[model samples]
Target: MNKIKLVLALVIFISFTALKTKDDDFVKRSFDAATPLYTSLLNLTGDNFKNYPHSFLPNGTVKYYQIDEWTGGFWPGSLWYIYEFTREEKWKIAALKWTNSLESNQFNDKHHDIGFMMYCSYGNALRFDNNPKYQQILVQSAKTLTKRYSPIVGSIQSWNQRKSKGDINTWEYPVIMDNMMNLELLFYASKVTKDDTYKNIAIKHAEQTMKNHLRTDYGSYHVINYDPKTGKVLHKQTLQGFSDESNWARGQAWGIYGFTTTYRETKDKRFLKTAVKMADFFLDHPNLPADGIPYWDFNVGQAGYKPDWNFDPNRFKTTPRDASAAAIASSAMLELSTFLNGKQKEKYYNAAVKMLKSLSTDQYLNTDKANPYFLLKHSTGNLPSGREIDVPLIYADYYFLEGLLRYQKLKK
Candidate 1:
């Protein structure tokens, strides 16, 4: 009788497990269509964005043009991530070519984006091979970043004199919302080099952001005004969003990811709590489209009178389908979900699954059987240049792969 009871229990367990696996497999099938689309982008871009290069201007040029400033470097990093997943030599060769191109830009002290510079290039290379030079490059980049920290503000300024001609304009000081996403590189540098200074600076920058960058309701602004001398938060403004007062979709997404990362590093409940709050705000906002993707700006479809003119073909509106935001937010959701236990974890897990499904099936995904770039419709570099409106964006491809990898790992 004991043997029979044991056998019966085993059978029940196996049967129940199979049913859950079947259900999970069914849900994962939705990603099947998107997987190849991502793989195709890796193929077409050819490791270094060579095949579908950043387009040239009407003057017929072919230099390293970018869609936007904040994440243009992320393009190569994205390719590296795909290579990490696929382990294809083609991706590696492309990544090497792109990293080679970035050499001249490194240590130039032009921009405050060491994360984009080191994380994708040297960071990826170092991970694969214990190369001393890559470590040197990352250390040099970190030092350059450290120099940007203001004693007053305790944060690295985003724009530099290269843009302002040694003016030290207040507009250039203080961390932009996007800088939070890149701070991880510095934190990583600290761990690899066994240096506390890098970690300290990175944390200080985040603390400054918490005090100044985030708004009353936890909706963050894109830019903050700082007194360069005192490092004071003078004012906060929303440059690219609908209004200085209105919420920007991408900014919210950045908050969701950045704060969560900060919390992971420090284990500070405030950062974790802040991340959950922001994530909740993003998921709960009525402005979000039914499909889980968001408009470029929250005020795009407000209940007021229509705009005097519809979106101009020549001029891209500040508000439109921002697939990039959705992709980033999806990755953040996975991270946030994994950290939580029990019911909270399950809720975020389901939401992330939903977002990924939406992204897979959404009309914006350019799954044109013939088109090489899977993520064709993405908006980027929206403010400075009106180019690449709702078109294939390289970063979109990058984040989609990241989110997929996160989901795949969660299942295990």
Candidate 2:
């Protein structure tokens, strides 16, 4: 009996060791893959730092965007993550060069995505280096962002009203679920400046978003239009989902990430509870794939979820899955797990592990040298607009690296 028990114990030890080695190998592989991919991107973009790698086109060519675009920061942010993972000086030099290129956007208040632009870049810089210069840039960016906030609307404006392609401008003051992400800049500024104004605005915006943007089931609307003068909700709609009422996968992921950050910064139970609900809603949805990736929108093929404007029943099977959303949610869930205990924490952590595993596979990870600059594939940017239908996105790579780093830290 003693000999049998010893053999069983040895088997368990070997199994655990193999699992640990496998997990570590995944992180190393991801870092190894990213190092060369980004190195190639830096060489391709060569000296013209203003143009950032955005995505791959359907023709398999790399698409670049100017620094002012919302996704510009993600490249630099990914560099920072690579730096953190590898501790290589070359990545640090590259990250600083790419990050400093966007310093001029500290004054850009045209959109709420300034947070996505500046925070993801300079914010990571601050995290890794703790430079006073990065802090100043972030504080100024937060100040600029505050200009978009209205006392009546109680939220930051996401986009300026504009006409495009013969479409009339009907939205007076539109706030999006994406705006929740910008509040982090404000929260950081308040902490650094020791002024309550920034934090106050962030809290109010979060409160209003919780009040208006969330459904009874905790699914988020992509956009919420408000009357600029009276604070009345004029319309609840979507600019990127299958339907105005559908749960856009990336939007849900954004809500989960944003609220998790909010709860981390403020330690507010309400935000914590809301984050949990949003995560649960996404994870528990029947339409979510078994591999943990979700379709571009949860209601794309479902009955009663078709868009009233452009319905296409034939597009059901071809609906692209968003690996970006899975990456973002995985990163968020890893953090959210730290705040819980017992089975809830285990559930979130295990789900995050599942997502990371799925994303690391060749099915999702970009293994083809034909498009080696980008990381993950099959991310749908804007399906209704017929843009970037199925391609590798910069932010997808950023969040995927982030999720891996977060997972690595938790495992340690």
Q: Which numbered prediction scores highest in lDDT against the true structure? A: 2
What lDDT score is found at residue 305 in candidate 2? 80
For model 2, give the 10-residue run with minimal summed lDDT: 161-170
On a 0 to 100 scale, what is the lDDT of residue 213 in model 2?
92
| TM-score: model 2 vs. ground truth | 0.95
The residue-by-residue lDDT of candidate 1 on 1-412, one tens digit each, is 9999999999999999998686465235434544475455446555453223442233433224442333445556665766676677866766666665565444646567667656656677665667787777777778777777886778888875223212333464646788887777788778779988988888888888888877777777887877787766666666556555667788888888888888888888888888888888788888777888888767654655132223343454445677778888888889998789998888777887777766666465555543444453555535323455455555665677678778878877
The lDDT of model 1 is: 0.68
Candidate 1, which segments miss by more than 4 Å at Cα? 1-72, 161-174, 301-319, 369-371, 374-376, 380-387
Stretches > 4 Å off in candidate 2: 1-15, 163-169, 315-317
lDDT tens digits, residue span 361-399, model 2: 888887666486988888889888878877889999999
Which pairs clash in the backbone of model 1?
A: 68-381, 152-231, 153-231, 376-391, 376-392
